[model samples]
Structures are given as C-alpha cells and as structure tokens.
Target: MARQDTPTNEMSLRWTVCGDRDVTVRGAEPGDVSALRRFIDGLSRESRYFRFLSGGQVGDAVVSRVLGRHDGRDIALVVTDGEEVVANAVYVVNDADEAEFAVVVADAWQGRGLGRRLIQHLQQLARAAGLRGMRGDVLSENRRMLAIVRELGFSTRRAPGDAYVQEVSLRLAAVTREAWLAHDWFQG
Candidate 1:
C-alpha cells in the first residue's frame, strides 16, 4: 500500500501542557495494538462505562476498525508516553462536507490536556485531508470532554435519544488551514 504523505508545516509549532510528563502524539500503527489495549484497560471503570456505555471490554473487531486504513478520507492518531499508548483520536470522513470524530484518553492521564492535544491534532488532520467540518457525540456528563470541545470552539447541541440517556452532539467549526493554525492548542 502507498503511504500517505503528511503535510509539512512552514512555520514553527508550539504546544502548551499542564503536566511535567513528556508525551508524544503520532499516527497509529498496526503494531501498536497491544499498547493500545494496555492503555484502554487502564481507564477507570467509570471512564470505561461512560465511553462504551457498558462494562464489557473493547472488542477486537472495533480495534481492527480503529487501526484500519480507509480508501476515503480518514485518519487515526495515538498519543503515547514512550512505549505506552495513552490516548487516541480518530477522524472518519463522512462526505466532502463533513467528518465524524472520536477520542479516548486513559484515566491516569485525565485532566492533563492530552485529550485536548489529541483533538487539536485530529482537527489539523481533518483540515489537511480537505474536510470542511467535523462532529461527534459525547455523553453530557463527561465534563472534561465537554470543556475540551468548548475550548476548541465546537458548536454543540443536545442529541436526540431516550430522554433518560444523556448525550450531546458537538459540531466543530468549518475546518480551514487558517483556523487550525490559529488554535491555541495546535502544536504543528
């Protein structure tokens, strides 16, 4: 298979973090499955419950889908501390006009800006892939994720569902090279 060419930035890049630990965020590779599993397994029971809406583990088929390549426009990125996968963000191209997004961060790394960084990178990837907008559903009680989406300027609306089940749809602003460059969280 032909490799996708990542875009080159013409200017210097900067990232802001609230923690001391060093983190690296990059495109996910097939070989990183075990690391990804380890990180996912480390999330708190509540976090896992919130993310998957169930107690069951993330299955192999889902992992394969997350790690697979697409003939259309899509990208998946993983954040790591050396050999461990601590977070992942994915952008699934829906059409010429929009894309779908999802992100997961380990419990141990929560509240440290890794999710924000991952989303920022995902946004850059979306723009580079020529997508116009992005959207996703987040549980309403997931405040950390809500704050991240709000900080990134996504317009959110209550999702239609069983009234008792809480969730919201986050729709990001039209993705453009200039807007991505202007984002405070963008590192490259």
Candidate 2:
C-alpha cells in the first residue's frame, strides 16, 4: 500500500488499502456525533448485528457511549473519506492489562481491508496506552469479522455462556514487534 499526506490535522492518519483507496483515520471528537450517526445509519441490519451483536435498532445511547471518554481509559477511532465516517473502532481499557474492543465498517466499505487497518491502528493505540492486549467478542456467525481477526493473529475462544459468540484477543507486544520488523525491512 502507498500513502500520500494531506493537510487534515484533525484526521492525521492516512493509509492506502485495497490497492489505492486512501483512508484517513483519527481519534473521535465531540464534533463527530452526526458523522457517527450517519455511519451507523448506513449499516445494514446484519452488519449492525455483527458489530453490536443485536438485531434491534441501534440506539442513541450507543452513540453517547462512543462519545463518552473523559477518563482516558477508553479510545475511539474513526476513518473518514473527507465527508463522513466510514469505519469506527473502539477499546475500553480495564483495570487489568487488557482492553475490550469492537469495530464497525460501513456496508459500502467492506472487503477492502479497512477492518484490518482499523484493528492494527487500535493495537498501536492500545500498546501506547500501556495495554497488554485488546479483545472483543464476535458472534459465531460473523465469519467475515472472525476471519479478519484471525488473519491479524488474534486468538479466539468461545465466549463464556454464549455458544453463538467467540472471544478474540491479541497481545500487543507480539504484533508490535512484528509491525516494527516489517517497517524496518521495508525501509532497508
């Protein structure tokens, strides 16, 4: 993938995925509530179910939770295409050395490796926050998300008491070094 930078400071992260499409990712801010709503609205019911593990309509409370992050113990990231949010990733850090994470990509943006990029960005952010790992529970039927997590090297186990869900986790140090090595080799 190749990247070309632009002057969007609020969304400083830029990358190329799926060959040549450019995506700019950045931390979510107060101003993104409308964008977040629009992104959620664009998702299909199945897509929302896979991400939130629910079949009902997405509530404003979910948006508020995504907006809430006063203690610095949680991180929310959004990828944009200069107009609206196309993907969202978040991790809620616990007292332990790990965090619980979740991600949702717009229906129009699926299958382009955006999910993988979001997970990688989340891993980097979690590692910087002194987190040991990041984890999330995925519905068993959500094969696409499960495959993405597995491809990124996360380990999966059955979510307790829920035969339909699988819990996935990844150790930060493990992937951190691998990412560094890849970058180092590329630069050599």
Candidate 3:
C-alpha cells in the first residue's frame, strides 16, 4: 500500500504550549508504536482511568489497538517535546458522517493548553477529510474534559443509556473555521 503524507504545519497547525515551549503537533506514523507505548506507560493511574476507564497500567492489547492504522479511518495525532510524546489524540470515522475522538495529555502537561490545540487540529483534519463533525464520550466525572469541550463550544449531553458518560460533539466546519479565525487574529 502507498503511504499517505502525515499531517503537518503546512495544514495550518503550529502549536506552542506554555508561551515559549515549542510543541510539534502532528499525525501519528505507523512506526510510532514504541513511543505511543511509552507515552501510555507514563500516564498516572488516575490519568489512565480518565482516558481508558481503566486504572493501573495500560494493557498491551489496548496499546496495539491504539497503534493500529484501522483502515485509514482512524486519524491519530501526537504532541511531542523534541522526541517524547507528551499528549495524544485520535478520531475514528463512523459511517454516520461523524467521527469519535479521544485525547489525553500527560499529567505534567495537563494545564498547558495542549488538549485544546489537539482538538483544534482534529477539527481541521476532520473538515479536510470531509467529515461532518467529531464526537467523543467522556466520563461524567471527567469535569476537566467536559469543561474544555464546553469552552471549545461543543454541544454535549448525557449519553443515551449511560448516565455515567457525557457525549460531546462539534461541527467540523464550525470548529475549524473558528480555529482559522483565531489563527488569523493572532497573526494580525
């Protein structure tokens, strides 16, 4: 199979965290399994709980699934400091013109605005891929994530049949357009 070009800054994404920290946000490559594993391994139990709904160490099977290409429908991204993965995000397109996503940032990097940047990148990627919107299910207790999504203007509600989870979604055109406007405003 031929390789597709990974998403890069040419796509209008150049994320910087904490004002001066240069963070490279890009699509995950097939060869990044090891780095992905290391990143997951570094997550604290509580962080893993919020991310995977599982505590303690992340399983090998879960790692494998995360690293899979999934027939090109999965768009996985990572934010790295030099060569270390500090955060990760992914969205898998469903047949209903929407994609579901999950994002996790390392504990140390939690308050540095990386998650927002990753979501913005995903919104752009989803629009370019012709997706209508992106969605995700966050634990009801994951207030930080819920608040972030709310701040990003996602429409959210309790998931059907699951009071313990909340569903979040944003229209691709709406979000990516908002991001573009913010980018241009910053440039001006």
* Candidate 1 lDDT by residue in tens digits, 79-143: 76668877777777775556677888887777777777777777766776667777877777777
RMSD of each: 8.3, 5.3, 7.8
- Give the better candidate number (1 or 2) by lDDT: 2
For model 3, the stretches where C-alpha displacement exceeds 4 angstroms are: 1-14, 68-70, 173-188
**What residue runs in model 1 are displaced by over 4 Å at the alpha carbon?**
1-19, 70-72, 164-188
The TM-score of predicted model 1 comes to 0.75
Q: What C-alpha lDDT do the candidate models reach, one value each?
A: 0.67, 0.82, 0.80
Better of 1 and 3 by lDDT: 3
lDDT per residue as tens, model 2, 53-168: 76567898898677548477788888888878899988898767797889898999988878877787788778888888888899999999899899999999998899999999
- lDDT, model 1: 0.67
lDDT of 3 by residue, 7-91 (tens): 3554223455665676677767777889989999999988899999997888878877775465766787777888899998888
- Which scores higher on TM-score, 1 or 3? 3
The TM-score obtained by model 3 is 0.82
lDDT of 3 at 154: 96
Task: Output the lDDT of residue 186, model 2.
Answer: 70
